[model samples]
Target: MLLTQADIDGAVGDLSGVMRRTPMIASRTLSERIGCDVWLKCENLQRTGSFKPRGAYLRISRLTPEERVRGVVAASAGNHAQGVAWSATQLGITARVYMPTGAALPKIAATKAYGAEVVLEGTTVDEALVAARRYAEETGAVLIHPFDHLDIVAGQATVGVEILEQLPDVDAIVVPLGGGGLLAGILAAVKPRRPDVTVVGVQAAEAAAWPRSLAQGHPIAVTAMNTIADGIAVARPGDIPFAHVSRFVDAVVTVNEESLSTALLLMLERAKLVVEPAGVAGVAAIMSGAVDLSGRVCVVASGGNIDPLLLSHVSTHGLTAAGRFLTVSATVSDRPGGLIALLELLRDLGTNVVDVVHSRVANGLELDEVAVTVSVETRGPEHQREVCGALSEAGFLRE
Candidate 1:
């Protein structure tokens, strides 16, 4: 069914009490960087740490009493699983969630904590979704799809409506695209009221489907999807969302892995927000100049349910991508003083040493030589270059 403005509004009304009114905060740092008034729609702070409940609750609530009695099942890497679990608990219905075997530990724990029977299966969300479907068929349970239904689209549309209410004068809405539910819902709600408003969808370059699908005039599934943003790693766009996105979205932009890491770091260090990689795709687009928004813009931070271990890795990656971190290897004298001297040199050169490792009896090491590797923190790209040049000049940098 086509998601009309009236349907979206009805969802908004239905969700007023159940869903949190997530904040829309202005970003001064981003505004200065992008040359436009920038605001963040903090859905990462919403219930279940995502915008999923807006749609999940609305869809489940509309179920007939008989359907509710049979229980609900869903497949998600994390966010949507938690949403369905939380919503089901609220409505006094049992929930069973199928998650990928490699899904984040925290998300799996959270989903179970929200009172769902958690089943770990497959290696990807699509695989888990297949399990959900079979369970639904076998047990007569309601399958709560992550995205793809009319009610789901309408429920997510409420986010767009809330954005317009919070920032009526905003000129553009930048949404992170996965299955296109969020982007489609936003376009349905925003474009109807403000036809002039620009609605753009941001997708991860590694696993993006909208660009290819839009070009081909049909939904095409991507194979071997791999990206840090597991939340938005949809292999294909849902039919409902694909139709809405094709008709109403002004533009769709893609951001690479480096930009995504950098944007997540920017939010953590600058905005002090713990946003997931998928949630920062919109910010990544702005930071990387993938999308040029010349007017007031609101970038939706779609989720915050990130694995801490992954965050640790992404933080190092972000630092390296921003030129704030570096690793160097060299051959040094096989003595304790040699390591101390290298550390001193780094300290004198205004670089902070993060870690140091040494190895002897290696292929390239002589009897008196040891392989030394150092990880250091720098200020920026120029600073890193300067440090590397200094090390090279001192004959301590290997290649």
Candidate 2:
């Protein structure tokens, strides 16, 4: 079904009480760095910690009473599962969510916490979706797809309506695309209203389907799919979304793992927001120079349901990418006073110690000599260099 502004408005009306009117915040630091006005659509703060709720609620709300009574089933890796589960709880309906076995722990816990029956089915979303379909058929429940249906597209489009109302002069919009529902809905709504605005779709480099799908003139299942952005790691594009994307979207770009990590860190440290890898793909594209934005740019932070352990790792990865975390190995005498002198030198260089590991047997060091590994936090690359130089000058030879 072709999505229209009327559909977007109707979805917005249907979701008024159920969903939040997520905030649009301006970024001074990003604006200065990009040489243009930058704003963030903070959907990471949305109910269920992702924009998936917008589409999930809209689709589920349209189901008939009989369908709701029969219950609903869905297949998802993370955000979509939580969205459907939360919507089901609100409507007092039963929901069964099928997720991949290796799905994030936080996503699995959150979905179950929302009063849904959770099943760890397969290693891939496609496999889990098959199981969900079988369950839906065996039982008389409605199957709520993540991004393929018209109602889902209509619901996701409501975000575009809010964005245009919040920033009338929005010159560009960068959105993360999975099956194309979010991009389709936004383009269907925004392109008609503002023809001059550039709408850019971003995808994970490891699981990019839109670019290939567009070239093939139809949806093609990707051969290999792997990425940290599990939220947008769709193996195939939806036909409805592909039609809208081919017509309305200005461009589609892919971002690498390093760029994704960098963007995630920037959001956490600079924007003070916790965003998942999929949530930061839009920012990743901009940071990696994949999509150029010369004027007003708005990046959609899509979700924030990242596991704490994964968040911890991504934080360190981001810091390492920014040269804020520095690791240095040195060979020092196994004596206690030798380690004390190195610690003093690090303090004198204004470096904050993060972690330390001492090894002698592992590296085949003599009993009198030990390999001291230190993790330090510095301001930037320059500061990191200063720390290394100070260690060398203190006669602690870095191995």
TM-score of 2: 0.94
Residue 255 lDDT (model 2): 94
Q: Clashing pairs in model 2? A: none
lDDT string, candidate 2, 243-309, tens digits: 8999888999999887888899999888999999999999999888898898889999989889888
Best model per TM-score? 1
Q: Highest lDDT, which number?
A: 1
Model 2, C-alpha of 35: deviation from truth (Å)? 1.0
Where does the lowest 10-residue lDDT sum fall in candidate 1?
357-366
Candidate 1 Cα outliers beyond 4 Å, as residue runs: none
lDDT of 1 by residue, 1-399 (tens): 578767987998899888999999999999999899999999999999999998899999999999999999999999999999999999999999999999999999999999999999999899999999999999999999999999999989999999999999989999999998888899999987899999899999899888989999989999978899999999989999998999888999899999999999999999999999999999999999999888899999999999999999999999999999999997777776987777888999899888888889667777988888899999999999999898888878766
What is the lDDT of every predicted structure here?
A: 0.93, 0.90
TM-score of each: 0.98, 0.94
Query: Worst 10-residue stretch by lDDT in candidate 2?
Result: 390-399
